[model samples]
Target: MKKYLLQSIRLTAVLLVLLCVVYPLIVAFAGGFSKGNGGGEKITKNGKVVGYALIGQNFSKPEYFWGRPSAVGYNAAGSGGSNKGPSNEEYLAVVSGRIDTLLKYHPYLKKADIPADMVTASGSGLDPNISEQAAIIQIKRVAANRGLTDRAVAELVVKNTEGPLLGMFGPSVINVLKLNLALDELKK
Candidate 1:
């Protein structure tokens, strides 16, 4: 029993150094090679920082494309989903409300045309990208609101559409912030 106790103590100490100290250092070092060098990749507008590339921001204006609804209100500090299942009344109502808002904004869309990502908050509640279909659905409203031709806005959407990883994995998605930024650039 004494030998077992010493083994456990040594194991705990080693794990503490490996998991708590070494692991974090390795991750931070790896992150330094990424876009923002251990911080988030920030986008700038007119020399002013706008938003992070990996986190979603709320864009409610009719002229801009919307991102996935965020259950955490797009709070990166507390990033999470609602945790309410489909059977939960609160979740259902929230989804219904989102559906109504989308229908109101894009009148031409039928219920079937709406993508699930547009109505449901993502698991992280901070997904910066939405399915391409979600962005396409908003083309008319965004085009009309911005006084730009639908074709032009559609072209921007096409330009902003990012293909799946390595063109082989996952569905194509559009980064809402990037898409809207491109839209603003269109106006200029």
Candidate 2:
């Protein structure tokens, strides 16, 4: 019994060090090679910091493409979903409201044509990218609001569209923040 007790203590200590200390150190070291160097990727506008690349932000104005709706109100510190299922009454109402608002801004878009990502908040409520279809659907509203041609905005959307990982993993998506930044540059 005493020998077994000693063995258990030793194993526990080893696991604690490996899981808590060594694992975190390794992850931080690996993150150093990533875009933000262990921090969130910083996006800049007019040479000033605006937001992070991996997080979502609100762009309610008609002149910009909207990102996925965020349940946490785009608050990074409290990122999460609404925890409501598709059939939930409140959830259905929220989706309906989003669809109505979208239609008000873009009366030309058919109800069935609106992509799910446009009206639904992502699971993490922090998805920075939207489906290419969602971005394309909003092009007309943005172009008209910004006094730009539909062709030009569509081209920008095409230019910003990111292909699936390894050419086959996920659906094509466009980073809304990056797309809006490029659109602003085009205006200038």
Number of the top-ranking candidate, with TM-score as the measure: 2
Q: Count of backbone clashes for each model?
A: 0, 0
| lDDT, candidates in the order shown | 0.92, 0.91
Per-residue C-alpha lDDT of model 1 across residues 1-188, encoded as one tens digit per residue: 99999999999999999999999999999999999898879999999999998889989999999999988889988999888877999779889999999998788999999999999889999999999899889999999998999999999999999998999998898999999999999998
Q: For all the candidates, what are their Cα RMSDs to the real structure?
A: 2.0, 1.7
Model 2 alpha-carbon drift over 4 Å, by segment: none
Q: Across residues 1-188, which tens digit of lDDT does each residue of candidate 2 receive? A: 99999999999999999999999999999999998788868998878989898778888888899998999988888889988987899889999999999898889989989999899989888899999889988999999999999999999999999999999998898999999999999999
lDDT at residue 109 of model 2 (Cα atoms): 88
Candidate 2: C-alpha RMSD after superposition: 1.7
The TM-score that candidate 1 achieves is 0.88
* Candidate 1 weakest ten by summed lDDT: 82-91
TM agreement with the true structure for every prediction = 0.88, 0.91
